[model samples]
Target: MNHSVDIVLPWVDEKEPGWRQRRIEYDQGKEIESTNIRFQCWDNLHLWFRSIEKCMPWINRIFLITCGHVPDFLNLDNPKLRFVRHDEYIPKEYLPTFNSNTIEMNIHRIKDLSENFILFSDDVFPLLPIEEEYYFKDDMVGDEAVENIISTGSFTKGLHEQRYAQVNNMFIINKYFKKREVQKKDWNKWYCEDYGDRLDRTRACVYWYDFPGFYDPHMANAMKKSTLARLWELEPDALDAGSRNKFRGASDVTQYLIRYWQICTGDFVPRRTQGKVFFPTIDTYKDVVDAINNKAYQMISFNENCTPDEFEIMKRDINASLEKLFPERSSFEK
Candidate 1:
């Protein structure tokens, strides 16, 4: 906890009108990421800042990455907030990108960013107070290194979607690291009790000398700028390809690739999986509400898949719950 940690929150206010036009103009053919559901605002972003300010007040700074459109409610005057535009950090060639992966892959380029940071999406919200160790310990980041096989469904469409990125990440990871050797070097770390049942998952796949895939936690990502730079040093072309992708393509490696490098290299401290994820379909709408009301997990993520009407209803309920929990205007608010 002696070292400082920052939160990198990349947001999209597509409702701003300019975002859609910019996206359409840039739509050379990236269909997978051009869905409305992908950019929907739940109108609960204020609660996210409130949760951070109240729960993790010791946070050093908040780098709010935007596409030149800041949220009206955000306190631009706040000393802790640093507004970042896509062109500011991302290289000029990767400009006008619609790919979230494209945006994320360049975060290490953000100036004055901490060596240790958590990548928080607009969908993830902390429900409880968290210490710095919750993300990092010593020089290692906190994570559970559970392995998994990419399901057949992942390649069904043959499009380079997120699952495609997972395969691409492992492809590069295996190229750099021999699984048998890494597991042998960090045997205890790989087989730690913190992984619980997932240890068996890794055990099941141990026979393979190469990694198939890392479990996609669908939660916040803890990362380091130096590790990112290391990956760039190791494989500049792979990263450059990812960055040049105006929209996420199958060949484009993700930020998860960096995390995989960290894990395979044993740069992570063991941590128990501590968050819950809800797919916001009508079937699970009630479950999301119950979790919030119960204070179920330390944090939660809503993977949007519901219909427009269903989301409107879910959005209203989510706002109600968060507003009730954090009634006062946080310092991050105007």
Candidate 2:
């Protein structure tokens, strides 16, 4: 299948005064005021772009979902690369109260557009090019490990309404099917006072129990354009317009939909793999380089330990495969 994957990242500029200081303060144990919160979201933006460059011969469109202030240095004229800003889709009235900008943008895009694409976060750095098989691998890690993590963490039982639903941050959705199913619901009243309390309770329970291990509650996931359009049809006002300007507080809305799906349909398949090879977070450039080297070593070790001759053959084959996959990247000077 010729899949169109849209890699999305929300970013903000650092030129604003005290931005660096704010990040440092927040990273430390200091009690910085929430009003003055500053995150270097662009750092991850650059990393994501670099990874895309390294794994080239781009398969689909790359969408940098932002709220206008994208740095000029990162600008490029690639036909496949697009920048979708929040103000374009969100209504001005509800922007202030919205907490999560990232989720809202995604929902807005899904609601307004009708394409099947993958959504990704800037924080996640792919060390090596991932083939289709790597994404849909068998023998996946299950809910058991996630359950163990929740049990050990600060989670309480019965706080949430549902069980057996786990959250994995990275996932792929067949948007065409998802959007078709969403049109039948009434989203305006979904979060009303009567339903809000119950939903909150359920979410709290899921967060405490099913978040870390089973799901990547923090990372991004993939879905189809049709699914988003249906969500928009159900609740054009579902996202708070004000929160779209920044990256924080958006996942809550995303989680709301995720939870709704869990209740409506009992399908929660893990999308990305979680193991030594796939690190969930990357804090620095060194981290990115290390991860790639590690994966290469692992591939080599697997072959060498079993058959030394095969080890050399595998290296040559892998290099050839990469070259074929990314011809432009040969000049990347790695």
Candidate 3:
């Protein structure tokens, strides 16, 4: 029983030359404005790899997907790591993409990617010593904590439009499974039972939830390459909807589709852990401190929804915490 699993991280260097101009040009004529490009890298690649080496040294090959923006400090000579640019696997038509969704949709196409792999972002790091079983048990993926999918009420109210895409993707995914009718009913019922009093029943909109599973946070996400390939074969339209967008859009499918598809198809094994995995919204210094103090959290992530000033503050705090947590340089560092 081979339990080997690999790691894939989709990263970007926001300050890459011409990135701003390219993004501006790409934005011309799109129906929706995409904020996915607003993320800050903070040059944390070395720190993130160091965390992996410190906590999960047994991980197989690490694939860093980027737009040819390899970190200057990265040890390209490291045998266990590979740098994959968008031109390597993603179709040429979708090149020069700032859309994370487009990049995520094509990661499974990486050559020789392990059948079982864990997908994470550079902003996410393992908080404590983690075992292979933390992400995969008995060769099946599932262990990272999951949250309930938001249904009804303000899924589309935000100005940023990321959540709007999330909800729309969920609807498309359900429709593909032919579960739209029943899932819609279940969602309406759940919404009523949970928030019946707060809402105006007369004006409530019917929203669908991915009931069996919800989009987990930006922490490490486990995935099976074959399952993702199957998703592409089964729902090319959905995949295309996500891929064709130059940026994140309202109809774009999320990376969660891979996780949810695995759950829906019975390909996953629920995590055996007893306690919750802490992936806090990085709103303040306290949140980062709380995660640091709590060794129980196996993984953590810093989402990029804050103001530019706040982002700078959070990055300094997070990088400092990471430096303290993983002091020794990893072999992946130059």
Q: Report, for every candidate in turn, its global Cα lDDT versus the true structure.
A: 0.84, 0.37, 0.69
lDDT of 2 by residue, 1-334 (tens): 3344455555555454544454444334332223232332223344345556664335355666544555554555666667665565555543322234334435544332324344554444454565533321231111111211323333433112112122212122222224224322523222233432234533443433222222233334444454445555644443332234232322223533432343233222333233232321222223324444454421110101213343334434434433343345222223
Top-scoring candidate (lDDT): 1
lDDT of 1 at 296: 89
Residue 135 of model 2 has an lDDT of 26
Worst 10 residues of 1 by lDDT: 152-161
- In candidate 1, residue 90 scores what lDDT? 94
Q: How well does each candidate superpose onto the true structure, as a TM-score?
A: 0.96, 0.50, 0.80
> Which stretch of 10 consecutive residues in model 3 shows the poorest summed lDDT?
197-206
| Candidate 3 deviant stretches above 4 angstroms | 29-37, 143-149, 152-160, 172-215, 272-283, 293-296
lDDT of 3 at 149: 43
Count of clashing residue pairs in every prediction: 1, 18, 0
Highest-scoring model, TM-score: 1
How well does candidate 3 score on lDDT at residue 123?
64
**Residue by residue across 94-168, what tens digits does model 3's lDDT show?**
777878888988888899889989888776777788878767878777642233545445434333457666675
Candidate 2, backbone clash total? 18
Alpha-carbon RMSD to native, per candidate: 1.6, 13.3, 6.1
Which pairs of residues collide in candidate 1? 160-250
Task: Please say which candidate is ahead in lDDT: 2 or 3.
Answer: 3
- Per-residue alpha-carbon lDDT of candidate 1 for residues 53-156, written as tens digits (9 for 90 to 100): 98888889999998898788989999899999999999998888878888888899999999998889988888888878878888579988888898756443
